[model samples]
Target: MTSLLSAQESGIVLGSPLFAHINPRQLPQLLTQMQASRRRYNQGDWILNEGDPCQAFGLILSGTVQVLRDDFMGYRSIINNLESGDLFAESYSLAPGRRLTVSAMAAAGETGILFLQQDFFTDREQISRGGQDSAQVRANLTAILATKNLFLNRKLSYLSQRSTRQKLIAYLSDQARACGSRRFEIPFNRQELADFLCVERSALSHELARMQQAGLLQTRRSYFELAEQLPETDSPI
Candidate 1:
């Protein structure tokens, strides 16, 4: 565990969505009671490793982290990308003594994370005696978990497509709906996007070029515009 800064000294806005339901003035006390700590990670650092004991859950305060899973043969896949205010590993943390199934790595920038030990929330005495504060924290944790579950389900839907073009269309369509525009900037670049979609980079590039030439879409690096609607069938390259 890295040396941690006090919540106030860390400069994270307690009013962020993760803590929105709690009073800002009481954040410090809440953190103290929960035995939370703020830790920083440099670019490419591993914040959590697969098979490691998940004793705590983390909430991103700044920068980005990529959740990844690797098979026995060491083929890695990007599970998800988490940004500020996003929580990770809550399910594993809640299960006492369980090991993590995914590894979390800091993206290509500095990242700050707030970690709260599972025991802080699961201890029977604390839950029974701590009154409204503990209850609020538990409620917030439940809400966060529910939201993350929905996100994972959407990601699974995207990943389940059999064709690269279908995967691309599924991802782009979701992005369009999320931003409420036919044009939007995606977070991943070409190679990162390829890894995220679980496709060969060269194959993904070819598919993108084919789509652009067909007037289905226009893309410039991360920026994308849906020039025409995607087909209902899975279109393989």
Candidate 2:
């Protein structure tokens, strides 16, 4: 685990939404009280595996984490991608026995995580005062969980589309709206995007080519530009 001093100096912890509601002056006390630990992970590192004991949840201070689930036969599906300021594994960490169903892996480059154990919230005497301090912590946790739930709902809406084209359109349209621009960069690469959309890479590539030819969009690696207005129905060609 990295030291608190280093985390503070790096600004990773201070910048994260997990600590956004915390007062700057109280940050040291909060960290010490929660026994928060910081750790670094390289690309492709498995931060947590399915069935692993989820004693704690982590906030991404930098870089990204890919949440994936694998079946009994070893087929894997990407559930979600989390970036800086996002929290992961809170639901599992708070549950009894605290066993995780999904695996979290480091993506892109080096990632920094601020881990807070379950006791951080449960042990009121240690981390929270009776009045405003306790209420603020609860508010922070509620906000995080609500945001995560909404993100999952959006992912589900994207995945529910029947065709590869529809999925692509849904994802791109959502991204454009989120970015407030027709031109944007997506976080996932070819294979990762294929996995994320639950489509075969070859099929997705073929669809992209078709869409480009149809004047739907243009793509160069992760960057994309919507060349024309999307159709009402994103049905398969």
By TM-score, the best candidate is 1
Where model 1 places Cα greater than 4 Å from the true spot, the runs are 1-13, 233-237
* Candidate 2 local Cα displacement, residue 164, angstroms: 0.5
TM-score of each: 0.90, 0.89
The whole-model lDDT of each prediction reads 0.81, 0.81
| Total clashing pairs for each candidate | 0, 0
Candidate no. 2 TM-score: 0.89
Model 1 per-residue lDDT tens digits across residues 174-197: 899899999999988897898888
Please, what are the lDDT tens digits per residue for candidate 2 over residues 1-237? 134746543366666666665566676666676677888999999999998998888888888999999889766688888898788998898787868889999987999888888886776584545345445665788788898888778778778888999899989988998999999999888888988888889999999999999999999999999965896544222
Quote the RMSD, in angstroms, for model 2.
3.2
Candidate 2 deviant stretches above 4 angstroms:
1-3, 7-10, 124-134, 233-237
lDDT for model 1: 0.81
